[model samples]
Target: MTADARPWTAPVAAGPVTATVRLPGSKSMTARAVVLSALADSPAEILRPLRARDTTLMADGLRALGTRIDTSDPERWTIEPGALRGPATIDVGLAGTVMRFAPPVAALAAGTVTFDGDPHARNRPLRPIIDALRTLGADIDASPSGGLPLVVRGTGTLPGGPAVIDASASSQFVSGLLLSAPRFAKGLTLRHEGPPVPSAPHLRMTTHMLRAAGAVVDESEPDRWVVEPGPTQGRVWTIEPDLSGAAPFFAAALVTGGSVTLGGWPRDSWQPVDTLTGLLTALGAEVTQNDDGLTVRGTGVLHGIDADLSEVSELTPVLAALAALADSPSSLRGVAHIRGHETDRIAALARELNKVGAGIVEHPDGLDITPRPLHAASFETYADHRMAHAAAVLGLAVEGIRLTDVACTSKTLPEFPELWAGLVTGS
Candidate 1:
């Protein structure tokens, strides 16, 4: 199912919400894992892979390029590597992973592949990755705006070598190139020559996953990564639960002075759990991890915080919502790159929060939210999943909060509405 045009009335928490949420697999990890599995030396199995729209699109795109992926089993999807050839058209929806990660993989195909997406997707930043691909010897024709609605003319192989990119706009640009580097003829030595790249942890996740798949990678130096040409080994890849998608549930706990536990988290997480813990702890949430899972308990006292969320920018929307309900003021910085996400998050947050009477000052990189008396209002999601999560968190305390389209959450979490209702009702 796609996004529903009907507006959704967000549920308000009658009391402190207490529940354990079992979220799906991480979209980022699943996307990268699927790509690697398709390019592996042998057939591979991705255990508990995310079946969300974004990941499904990635799988479909790979299938168009002749990779055999059997996703009939929801729990375990199998992949068989084949000759990457394409004379296909790919619809990326609003997924950054599909827009960025799939292009490099498509470059390895034998025919031309036309790429497009939702209307807003054409506005996302794609030039950096497109230019980087060209630097490494791939034929691409981007739109006049240097964004999406482009075509990749593949010649069966890529002459990958040293390349430079300005990835300050999005970390996916770097990860995209690195994910497909091992398949290139000469491998890749990528260097970043711009402002500090956002989402450092995501880049680490990319490198870690690559190395785990038997690719030789060197990240000894800052802003530089060297990937030696080799075959990625097919193995059983168990995807971690999406910590980012769980942010709204955790925020619900914090907002209602309740508790929430997320199950199936790995002992050592590839996601930015440390950063999330620190941010939530700073806002008066007690976080603990053990055999059961990761639990966050609210003390009924929400404190304001000043944080730079560059590395974990994906958490900005929900964190910003928490800031709106804090006792004092909060300032979030170092996420200017989010302007190119599904929407201009900073502006959208400021506009919507302020519409409900929250005092917010929009900055180039982030927002400063001051606690105010919030009331009922219609929150616009702008077709962004994270924005819907933020609205849900705010609705827990502020009654009558409605979302323009809760179905937008289907982009990452299709079960958001049911799960959120259960959390509020303690089902």
Candidate 2:
């Protein structure tokens, strides 16, 4: 569902975003919720599940594999798990949600199931978890480089074995193991044996969701988690709004001199949006809360902040947008995991922001962006949805910004352009 195909765009100084926007459900939560609900025996109801392309793909893929899913409502879904029949072929189509989460979820199916996806999905490294699942008696195989186009023959030949899995690169691997623990012949115990793993909060999110769906999770040690295998008892689950997706607007409220309200955002969310409220406040923004939402108003020239976003790395683009208007340099750390995204985000930011006349430096772990005068230009999103969404937010701070492949945001936000239109009160 791509929108607005104009020849090109010159970035315009964005009007203060004062609209009361209701952000979408967490794609992360939505995808995992679908898998958990599908793995159970009873009917499952998920409220406010993300309905964007990635999550919808998860639902469709699971349904194609013989599970019953009803997603007639944009905000919710009903998942019914039952008998698995036939050798199923499923396509996830660049949806990391379907690719990473579905494989383990598919292990629960009784017949042979083959998983294939688009080029980007095929490129992501899945060897660590694949190796771990193989250790636990899963019959799965990947290409020579552990790329996708994976083939998983079903549970009939399921093995019961144990091995340590390295989760240093991405948390999805760990979450996959945790989500499908019950299906494994013998429940899996993972050993984290590298630099502290990335996206720890997302890992926590998955574990918390699994427990909510009725799984036993053990994290008795600092770097280890042991999951006991059992069926997820179907129940009610609610997906929280994505704090990552709301970061750009929150930054807009801090620098654009107006209040922006976001509804359905919780006072207590694992998401990083509210945590940055202090950072926004420190940057000269006034924040207030109401019954249904939180609002922000900017007072003056924004100031830079020092922060760490290891678990909240999705906020990088928004932080970069604010740094462009701040008085000093902004430094953020714990972002090495971004390389696993559609594009190497650090490199993409350094390259693309430079096109807009910003002085930015890329680090192996994070980025250093210093505020500078802005220039108008078209930027490449490199087919990365986050990169595309980030470019649009940066457009708010300055003028003359065009993002190519803007449709990429469909991975999580298909109507971002429309949402922005509403936020800016533009047609």
Candidate 3:
């Protein structure tokens, strides 16, 4: 069970699994809150922040920029915003949030902040954030090849006025800009022009958090946001359970002909996976939400669903796995941008599913899955957490399915294998 050392065989369910799975803090919300807290005018407290590889890197990056983060209790952090000064280096690993979000903050530091990551991390998009920062008057030096191994010359200030960026590659580009925009002299008015930003709900999450922290954000117009600059107020921020991380567990209900309950489901929230409840319902699962949380029960009959997961692209892998196990066909559309995620999700999903004897067609933008008798096979996780999640969900029904690099789930859900084992065994 060591990290990055072994390929684990996913366990198969016997009859029906009945368990309540508690997930860790939200990766999306944790990253955003940490970045915003670091940029706040005063120290702030974050309760239940995710202590995973990605979020830890973000905290380290902020600390490198002279933010005093007290992680004595890793879940509860009291972050004291200090004068931004960094003649330091940040290892972003493969976390897009750390790579994209930290740079803008680094742009406002007193000294240079050098950023790099794993070899694969260097291939993820950074030019959009780099170009946008340069447009907003921040001095940066980067390789001609596009990403990573770059230095931000932080003179401790940024002249952020108006800028336009093509955020179609990743919405993190837009959120990164706005997260650090309040520190700029003129605030910021940003316009995103492209073939629609993928994960639109993430942008809305950014807007909500910004507004909650006392930043004036106007997203009234299409593809444009206006933020009036002022000192960001620090407050007590509470992190939520990651709904995207809860996806595989909820899906376990369907694949095993069982029931799964997830605690702490937000009554009203902008997390993209809130839409998943309806998706589960359409796929022949009884979904219920109440004061306790959300519960999903499978009737042993799963139907395929045609879904537009562009706004909640992270859920695509788990959904695709379910589609492969359904009685009919499923079409998932509007997520071409996902090809640029942790891995080329479309290609990876198609290849891996087919290896296990399922029918999945990789489209330019999404996937078309037709149910087939899936056989046991080794599922390769391309170092993608969701990829591992998909395989784990499938393994619930199909035996002899070994998942390689299962430790990649540490990117968000650090205790994934252990938690999944507990759920499967109900011990």
lDDT of each: 0.94, 0.75, 0.90
- Report the C-alpha lDDT of model 3 over 177-274, residue by residue, as the tens digit: 99988889999999999899998889999999999999999999999999999988889988988999999998999988899988877787668655
How far residue 407's Cα lies from its native spot in candidate 1, in Å, is 0.5
Q: List all candidate RMSDs to the true structure.
A: 1.2, 2.5, 1.5
Model 2 lDDT at residue 362: 86
Candidate 1 residues 85-160, lDDT tens each? 9798999999999999999999999999999999999999999999999999999999998878989999999999
> Candidate 2's error at 241, in angstroms?
1.7
Q: Who wins the lDDT comparison?
A: 1
Model 1 Cα shift for residue 388 (angstroms): 0.5
The sequence of per-residue lDDT tens digits that candidate 2 reaches over residues 1-427 is 1254322242344566566778888888888888888887689999997788888788888887788999998766888986754388788877766777887766666777788876676777788878877777768878987868788877643443456777777888888878877656667677877877877778888888888888888888887787776677898878887767776667666666777777877766655555667767877788877677877787866888888777777777777767767899888778887777777788888888888887888899888888889877778877677777677767776666887666777778777777775665544
Model 2 is weakest, by summed lDDT over 10 consecutive residues, at: 1-10
Tell me each candidate's TM-score: 0.99, 0.93, 0.98
Which residue ranges in model 2 land beyond 4 Å of their true spot?
1-14, 156-161
- Model 1 reaches what TM-score against the true structure? 0.99
lDDT of 3: 0.90
Better model by lDDT: candidate 1 vs candidate 2: 1
